[model samples]
Target: MSERVVNPTGRGFLLLDSHPAGCFATVARMRAEAGGDAAGPGKGPVALVVGSSAGYGLAATIVGLARHGIRGVGIGFERPAGRRTATAGWYRTIATASMVAEAGGDFTFVNGDAFAEATKAEVLDLIAERFGGVDHLVYSVAAPRRTDPATGVTHQSVIKPLGAAHRTRSMEFDADGTAALREVIAEPASEAEAEATVRVMGGDDWALWIGALAERGLVNDGFRTVALSYIGSALTAAIYRDGSIGAAKAHLEATAAGLTDRLAPWSGQAFTSVNGVAVTQASTAIPGLALYVGLLRAVLGDRMQSPVEQSVQLWEQLTGARPLDLDEQGRIRLDRWELDPAVQAAVTERWEAVTSATIGEHADVEWFRTQFRSLYGFDVPDVDYTEPVETDLPWPT
Candidate 1:
């Protein structure tokens, strides 16, 4: 078959084929950061990672397999390959599973809505039949909407500020010509909207997953679970730190605390991990985050780390000999690097001076665009995009 083509447009780039090289690059990074294979392990520990198909979850899964030689069961919601479009997460999952199998690790990919009780039941059955139990449960789920199992109420997350509308510079790539910066205003979210955001993005589902697992006797003793969260600088506070999503994060953090207590009998621990901001599918959808990420990247420069790198750091801290370090809020601080005073100062300086006219010169627009495209399996230097690709690739069985 010929290599898949990439059609770039203003909205985003669509991949025509599965870029194996790009996927392999992700694996290579995982290996490098892990510092070679871990010693003395029988297929390592087993892990169940929700949202393991992409973003932080994908990187974490890769690290588990490549670095620690863990057997992995991944649950993700992804669009199947259609006549006209192929989902990047589907391909990434396939590529990741293939690599793990080749490296002599067991991997299973389940594509479905993680919030559904049926999906949770499926996970429990799989673990019973295969790995018996999981040592780690990583929750990195990001969704625009979530349906409550009890109330049957579906809540949609909004990216608006909480109190007042905030205006900021936004960047967009023009498929026709040059990149453009425009003034984007994010309106305040209503009380109901804020509640809905928390309902969708909050940790209710996460808590439910743990409860179900524990009740089913699937959680092993000393098992640990982690949910990813974020706390950026003050610059984006209105729409981020103190915004609707922030309310959700607060709920998530609180959930972690409550779950920790619930799991105390089994010596299990639950933690909310504060991660650094990166170019992710979820981040791009946030109203004014793209501009901030671009500026943050420019300001951080070499200090900025990718999800793969951050995953390794997290793994080391969790699995290493030393006890995990947490902030006063009882959360892992993976975002400490990003929240450094020097970095924030620089970002603030740039944020204040940035305008439509100066955005091009001040922001790392190209880097942001490249990272965004990379998530979709495009713009990898080693990948041959000119060749025709097989769109109907099989999922890892």
Candidate 2:
């Protein structure tokens, strides 16, 4: 009798680990192609990553070290771990920071808020005193709740569509890809709501952090910066593009434009990566996304690019390759892959077949859901979930 074991990394580890590496590689290439020697930039960079605990930002930190071959400092302010639940990204950071140090690179983690002036000051002081100044800054913050530093009012962003409530069927893969009836989702947000969403997501925090650092003499000329964003697909348009999140991204794109202008004198530019969708801790919560993931999986091939792969692709764009193909809004448009004629043809075809007139458990959807469930450290075939999961994640200092 033999027992099967599913490794933890098998779930979503690759997306987390390789994502930043791919982006950094692209950044390095961009630096090289710009006819600018990549390494002359201020003894490399003391890299500062906002939202550095998980998702795209953490990947950026890891990628900065692994792919870019640049070494300096890393800083962020993620809340320390709490009772019972451990953030997956934090663990990955530990492992990644250890890898960076072993290779003789500097990595530092300061958990808190990117928007907080105090936190920003702390990051700058750390960089100025110990590592000189940061040569690059990566803004990847994605918080849903923000208290206006001035107003003191707490705000929460919703994951709803931007237009009138629309009825759509998405998958609840946790129970197999049953075409669960997604009720007509909420309507488009008001201008005030949209602006608030943007305030939390837009480039204000990023610009502020960069400005503070530069003012403190931590920025050298030719520094580069980037932020993460998404445009999803037509299927997710209401919930994503026109939705509250979409509104925020719109503001984010504008934020980049402003940052680009502000940093022009330093020969620095801020670019936004219209990153593709993936099974991330963040992406899962977006309304109508589970179905998008399932269909996207069937469409992108069994090789649906993991977040790490997507990040690599992102890196390629960031570092002087081709600015990612942009939309009318002048924002990166990687989400176009979701709506490509060929890719859409495939997902729609499978969706129709699986969710046809005959309604029962879809074996294909079931398999996908199982894999997805495994992503959250549940329902894996290889490892016993009952066994306490042990890891050796090295928290970056």
Candidate 3:
């Protein structure tokens, strides 16, 4: 394969291309850190992770293979247009499949819209033919829109607040690595808009997946399910915790209870994991979150947890290797350290005093940039970006 210099396209939270070598390196690093805790070959649980292309989904998949030797089925929506580069998630998947093969674990990737009924059916068929049943299902889908299969209605989620227009401090990063801080105002969502957000982002699809799996008798006894979520502190609460997306998250967490009852027949359980903050594609798109994460990393220092680290802990709880840390609402609180009182206090102090001119003094801008770029395989360590690399790598079957 001829080498090509793959620079990241788009700017300020928008990425259009990915580096294959860098994406592979990123997965390899995460797998190594997760450690080979697998008891033996074929000893791990059989898992299906929706949205397993990037962010928490990708991390969970890698951790499952490296830490638990899970035979995994990953569902994601990514594109690899001919001549142009594929999405970062596609490269990540290829790398992950290689890891699974090396570790002697089974893996299958479904590349399509997870919201569609056809996609659900395909996953069910795969489980029945290959794995017999699923032991754990991780719902980590993060999409801006979803079209209901039955109604043929498309719902687009918004990031606006609920009651009133919310204003917050936000930052924008250019492709050249320069960033600027500015104030952003997000308006209140209309009734229809709020409903649409819930439809796209809430637990509806998650519930649907479980319902289908249960109906197909694809759930093993002691089956477990978890949907990823985030509950930020007061720093970006107005734009995040109280925003339209937050409403959907609340619905997601509430669905866990009903789902537990559905899985009760198999003695199965369902939970919502409130994950810690890290630079992800979704997080970078939210207003003020980029800055908040930057400040959080600066204040927390080594206390900060990467998505992979959180996934490692999450599996420990799911597999009974560690105690589940639940909140009053019975949801796993992986974001506890991020929401710690001391950490919040420190972050708040920096948030208030940080200005456009002084952002570098209070925030870990370099770290934030690195994390964000690494999501698209641009700034990953040990990857020689100066060398030309193939962009037309085939997806692992």
After superposing candidate 1 on the true structure, give the runs of residues whose Cα lies further than 4 Å from its correct spot.
Answer: 1-4, 10-35, 39-41
Ranking by TM-score: 3, 1, 2
Q: Write the per-residue lDDT of candidate 1 for residues 215-248, one digit (tens) a residue.
A: 8888888889999999987887888879999999
Between candidates 1 and 3, the one scoring higher on lDDT is 3
Instruction: Report the lDDT of model 1 for residue 62.
Output: 78
- Candidate 2 differs from the real structure by a C-alpha RMSD in angstroms, to one decimal, of 6.9
Give one digit per residue, the lDDT tens place, for model 3 in 37-66: 786567878999998989999989888888
Runs off by more than 4 Å, candidate 3: 1-3, 174-176
Top lDDT hit? 3
Each candidate's root-mean-square deviation in Å? 2.2, 6.9, 1.3
Which lDDT values do the candidates have, in the order given?
A: 0.80, 0.60, 0.89
In model 3, residue pairs whose N, Cα or C atoms come closer than 3 Å (at least 3 residues apart or on different chains), thus clashing, are 3-388, 4-388, 4-389
* Cα shift from native, residue 333, model 1 (Å): 0.2
**What's the TM for model 2?**
0.78
lDDT accuracy of residue 183 in candidate 2: 37
**Model 1 pairs in collision:** 2-388, 3-387, 3-388, 3-389, 4-389
